[model samples]
Target: MTVLSQLVSLVFGGLVPGFLLGLLAFRVKSRWCPRCGESTLAMPPTERDR
Candidate 1:
């Protein structure tokens, strides 16, 4: 029972927050495309984009 509880704690404490942080980082970086390196902007550009 103790070992199982320890394992569950480890997974929740170590893995869950890490996974959530990774997802947050991914979402933030996803604004810029990896191939073209262009950022997704919320507002339209005032001038034509080159």
Candidate 2:
């Protein structure tokens, strides 16, 4: 019973949160455009800026 409880805690407390945080970090770090390496958050420049 103790072993089973420890296994459950290790999986739920460690593995699950680690996986979720890794996924979030991957998404946040991977949102840049491949060609220009620019973030998608900015609006494209207008003709006036060209």
Candidate 3:
């Protein structure tokens, strides 16, 4: 039981937060792209970040 609970906690703590952060990053990138007149598809989310 202890091991199972730890595994569950790891999944929620790591995977869930990473997924949510990625979603927020995507949203911010899209919102900022138009200001530079770059096509969102051409500019990678990581590249526009610079």
lDDT of 2 by residue, 1-50 (tens): 99999999888898888999999998987888779988978788999999
lDDT of each: 0.88, 0.89, 0.81
Pairs that collide, model 3 = none
- Candidate 3 stretches greater than 4 Å from native: 32-50
| Residue pairs with backbone overlap in model 1 | none
Ranking by lDDT: 2, 1, 3
Count of clashes in candidate 2: 0
Q: Give the candidate number with the greatest TM-score.
A: 1
> How do the predictions measure up, each by TM-score?
0.64, 0.59, 0.53
- Candidate 1 global TM-score: 0.64
Q: Rank the candidates by TM-score, best first.
A: 1, 2, 3
- Candidate 3 lands at a TM-score of 0.53
Instruction: Pick out the ten consecutive residues of candidate 3 with the lowest summed lDDT.
Output: 39-48
The model with the greater TM-score, 2 or 3, is: 2
Candidate 2 deviant stretches above 4 angstroms: 44-50
